[model samples]
Target: MSITERLSRGFVIFDGGLGTMLHSRGLSAGVLPETWNITHPEIVTEVHREYVRSGAEVVSANTFGANRLKYGAKAGEFCLENIIRAGICCAKAAVGDTGALVALDVGPLGKVVGWPGGVGFEEAVGYFSETIRIGAEAGADFVLVETMNDIYELKAAVLAAKEACDLPVVATVVFDASGRMMSGSNPAAVVALLEGLGVAALGMNCSLGPEQMKNILPEMQKYASVPVVVQPNAGMPHLEDRKTVYDVSPAEYATHMREMARAGARGLGGCCGTTPEYIRKLVGALEGITPRPITEKKLTMISSATHALVIGEQPLLVGERINPTGKKWIKEALLAGEYSEIAEEGALQADAGADILDVNAGLPGIDEAEALKTIITELQMITKLPLQIDTSDPAAMEAALRVCCGVPLINSVSGKTESLSAILPLAKKYGGVLVGLTLDDDGIPTDVAGRLRVAEKIISEAQKHGIDPKNIVIDPLAMSVCADPDAALTTLKTVATLSASGKRTLLGISNVSFGLPMRDSLNASFFTMALFAGLSVAIVNPNSAELQKAYRAYLALSGLDENFSEYIDFAARRAAGGEAAS
Candidate 1:
């Protein structure tokens, strides 16, 4: 059976930290452990055999720091491929025909992108590809990429694995005490991106022990559709008679490991400072415990560098004024390559109560691709609100998606063959909460059922390309009520249709009130109706007082707000002529 199949059966065991074990066996602190694959093959083989004997079902090869970029000039005469091959040879020898797998281990480049100390994304991808190719050729059954903190680097490594070999890949990231990765990816953000990228399994590893892992598991379990992996450190390191020791004993570690298993972790292992005894005890504690069944998470999450916004939990207002459709100043700024105006717009929208900022720099005079990259990078630096990469050009979309620090919401893909062919691959490759416009090659669907068919078609096509339906937010194409009096009703019915099928729905709510008198009142009323119809996200101008009041009222009426506080405050602020009273 494949590792994924075995994972579905029960908790699968992986070996513990190789670095600490090597340190006890006379390996120095700063020495690259991959060097020992060539220098001391017996010691490497012995470590693998000990883990197998201790009940480890997967023994990771001693190639954690084995990439060419870091070790190429440092390993003297031992080439990168030879060292990786040796590491795999030891793992294979130890496991023998016991059905235990040998996973070729890969670690971070210890580099950050666009910084003085980091390498480019493609460079990182090339380095990982070389090592992964070597490990696959050496007969490793799996590829385990661990200790990742940077999402971009993780993306590079994962892409390399999928490009280099057919091995099942499992990715584990290191999180801080604040329960976020180094690049500001929270558990939900990490899960949304990695699962979108199609890893066999995903989880947290290293930096924290079992207690912290327990706190972090709920977020992972909420978003992860795949088998969740949890390989935490035994405990924080402490000094004992000039020797480093972990605080958690094997029994205590196993106790918490059992709790994690019961909580829903199907893959269990250890990180720094753990040993064979840790795995042995963990396996014993979880001997008869069944793996938690995986469930589909109904969340529409989009993220920026520092935060994630889950659309369905509450009404999310996406600032739609960033597009240069009618904004003369914004259009001129985009044409002049002056993003200061664009940056100010983002800040203003964020201040006015927008949860996400919809970015579009598609002016006729500017290069949309370059404009998107610049705007995405700058806007993320200015505000914490996640961005909706709004564009019709595939090149602009791909460019923006690649540079975004977190999983953005790409707007959009449609049921049209040309659109699916162009955008679905980008969504799968770059990872996003892709917006599916409910229109096809034939044009905007005239009725609710037609729009629902297009939305369903978009979901079906996305899944065919390995993109999760949960990652898609459908837009039911709200036409102007002035043009067709029934358009508003049609959109609301379509929203209900998609919501009934467990799909998140978004709408440009203001479009419904176009060319109508008292536009704000019409827009706000239409928005309330859409909310009642299960609208997950509303792309609108947050500067409108009526819309903001409507949003606060909806929160209170839906019981999402506590004590009618938001509605009360909005009424007070409105009564005070939008002025704050100190």
Candidate 2:
């Protein structure tokens, strides 16, 4: 069956663990199971046939670790291409005419990508490319990337699948018992990142039992608009007679699987400690049970590797002190190639209640792309706040997007044809939360209606490029009130209009106060007006005490700050002569 059909049908069931069954057949530990596809094709075929007979609609091939990184032809006895080709052959032979689909199973390269001197992104892509290409040619139905512990390496594998073939790509990351990846990606962040990248399905698998998986599925369901695949382990593994065995029996495992299906696990399967009996029991238990409906969440979110920042949940603050604009210290740091100074700015904003950091490396006469890469890498090292990569240069923007550790905000795509053409593809490829400035080639509008027209155009172009409206944040283009007396009013009107239609609105609030005396005073007041007018995100200096007080008060009044804690903390800091922003 095609992947499109598999995803469309609610409650599609997949096969259980092959490694568990293989080990029971005396497959030695420390011996790669992928080699069995060639050396003992009969045993592998029978194992797949048992799962297919037990009602598995989709079976992943025995090629999870068959990539060159683990089984290079020069380093191992088996050739990588030969092993992958044989793996597909074994699964296809098992299915025969049973109408079961074969998925090319892919896994991580066993190394993290975003460490200081770890494997690079492109290098990880190269490792997955050859194996995936061979699998596609050998007639695998789709690519199933599972057991991913790091979000960066997971992204690399998906990019390879998209580039290698037209097969559908489904990804599943392993969350610990705490419901976070080893790299600190939580369920919401994983769902936000994968759904934005257009995965056929995405969810949790491995490193956790069914009970542990149940703890994190609610958060995944809240943000995911696509199918959620759940492949929990049978239970925690333990040593039984020096062999690994799971605690939960097949019957008990089915009970948890049934609950997961009702909780929105449309694609159900088994991981590490499960077997064909587990799949058989799960299928039988879920019989006649209607699957949970998948709904469009319409959440506007961006993330770092650690935290997912949801817009409209609270007053979203994009820290604006990292740019070289009007900041002499930043300009000096950029010119002197002192990246530590740039990183320090992001750290300070993060400590001062900034939800995201706005990174700009657009200094004149420098290689903006290289400067942006350096700035992005350093900022990611210093803080977990998602970055807003602010650059007009397309090359610099792409460079920054490539290096960002998680979901970043791209600043920005405009209504101009030139801007959309260059940026939409990058956003689509890298899956960043895109900021769309509502200004066309005709320039900033003089009135609210004109700017609204530009906003509509930006959304239209973004959808045409396959970007969801949820991923597009509309910036109403805050103009200086000194240039036009009604500029702030016009921007406010546009924000109110867009927010009413459920569009996320962002504003560079400092621009509204430009050319005015006592800028911070005007900025704080104007920011309050914009917040009341439904502004979702604001680019501002987070260290300003006036702005902090305004935001804290707003949160308390709006019921976002639980029990007035944030406002109380801010007041206590000021009363004690402590820096409110610090």
Candidate 3:
């Protein structure tokens, strides 16, 4: 059966290490193993046949390092098209009449992903798009973008596959012994980003063994709504005879694979130091166990490249100072292109316990798109806090989303026709926690029911574009009470109504106290009221002393502070003239 056909049935086993087998046959170290596809097609075919005979249902071709970067068409005798075509042909010949599937193994482009001095986002996308396009033309059933060490590179590859061809793209990243990517993505973070990018399955491979990889399985399972793919090394590597070797035996490795399968792995395989025997042992070991049904976590989440922040974990604080809405310094900084000022503001908010940073660079007579991109990139350099891409322009929103290192927050989409038309596609294409303001072309709703209807309309509209409603955080916007005596009551009622219906809610605390004296005191009470009403996120000035004190107090009183640690830490910071004192 095809891999997709078997996905619903049980675990679909993948072939073990190809480089290991190639080296055993005297393909020397550091000489591109991919060239062996054209040079010694028979050797490549034999290795694939061995895996198929050993019961591997899906065999990745020998095209792991076959990108245009390493083998550019210019001076190379080995072109990417020729190499990948030959590689897939070998795997295809082995799978003939065997009911197995072939996957073109697309590895990293050998550069930093989405970094300043590294490969740019579109350039990386172009490279992977060309390779995946060629792979689909060459008759591969799926694209396996494997051994990723950076989340941005993984996003680039998966986005390329989606834009390039219709093939199912599966991705796996390399996690260090600490259960984080070299770029610092934890398992939860990886799950959030890949699921956002819409990969068929996401996983870990290459760096650690089945035992070490096993320790991270629960975290992946906790957040993963799709199949969790794992291809751990046979064991940890050690130097022997001046060469690297793995320590675990095939039987020992299979034992661990079986344990991982039971714990929520829907796809299992081996990385380095495994031959066909490992697959054979693994296949036999997984005979009677049923695969766990993939869970629908429905979490409202966003992430940096390093960590995931789930909403409803004691109301997230999104720092509101990065935007140029009312901040003259930010406006000046954006116009002057002073990234240092932006970074400093981001750092300060982070120090004051902001869970996410709201980034906006929209100003007249400037390219909002370009400024948003620049500010988002610069802020990430200073902190790993997930960013909220705040802009009224659709172009600015897209530009910021394109370069964001991890899953971010799309600051808004309201009930208006134009807003929904432009923004939902971005949110759907680039995964994020979308904030939907409860307003439309009819303007701000005066009644709680009208606002609730708008939120429902947004949830419905976002769903039409295939956005999970859980990913939509409803903002029953806080209007000034000076304008309407019952405005705060309407917003609070809408927040509580949405919260009761299992919808995540957000509120801008400052909006309620606008045009009022002692606004900080009023904002703190509003914030506490929103918390009691089950707010999920608050866009506020994290540097405000009264607001900080109120938030810490709420957490401590509600038992969300875990033995009052967050509260005690806030008190300690206040004593030290920190944010609470400022």
Winning model by lDDT: 3
Ranking of all predicted structures according to TM-score, beginning with the best and ending with the worst:
3, 2, 1
lDDT of 1 at 245: 87
- lDDT per residue as tens, model 2, 1-582: 576566667788899999999988879989999999988999999999999999998989999998877776444448888899999999999999988889999988877786766788778888888889999999999999999998878878888888788899999999988888988889888887787667899988888889889889998998888889999999999998987889989999999989988888888889999999999999998988888778988888898877798888777999999999888888888899998888998999999889999999888868889888888878877788988999999988887877777788899989899998999999988888888898899998888888889888988888888888888899998889998888898899999999899889999989987887998898998999999899999999998888888888888888888999888888887878755444
Q: For residue 275, what is the lDDT in candidate 3?
A: 89
Off by over 4 Å in 2: 73-77, 578-582
Order candidates by lDDT, high to low.
Answer: 3, 2, 1
Residue 95 in candidate 2, Cα distance off native in Å: 1.6
- Candidate 1 CA-lDDT value: 0.87
Check candidate 2 and list the clashing pairs. none
Per-residue accuracy of model 1 over 1-582 as CA lDDT, tens digit each = 777887878789989999889888999877778889888988989998999999999999998988887668755458887888989998899889888999999998767754446786668888999999999999998899999988768878887898899988899998898888888878877776677667899998999998888889988898888899989998898899998889999999999999999999999999889999999999899978877788877666777655677778887999998999989999888988999778889999998889899999888878999998888767866787788999999999988887776778899998899999999999987788989998999999899889988988999999898877888999998899899999999999999888887889999988888897899999999999999989999999999988987888889989999998877877787778856533
**lDDT on C-alpha atoms for all candidate structures:** 0.87, 0.88, 0.89
- Model 2 global lDDT (CA atoms, 0 to 1): 0.88
Model 3 C-alpha lDDT per residue in residues 220-318, reported as the tens digit of each score? 999998888899988988999988789999999999999999999988998899989999999999999988888899887799989998887769999
Candidate 2 RMSD computed on C-alpha atoms after optimal superposition onto the true structure: 2.0
Q: Kindly give the stretch of ten consecutive residues in candidate 2 with the minimal lDDT sum.
A: 68-77
* Runs with alpha carbons beyond 4 Å of true place in candidate 1: 74-76, 114-117, 516-518, 571-582
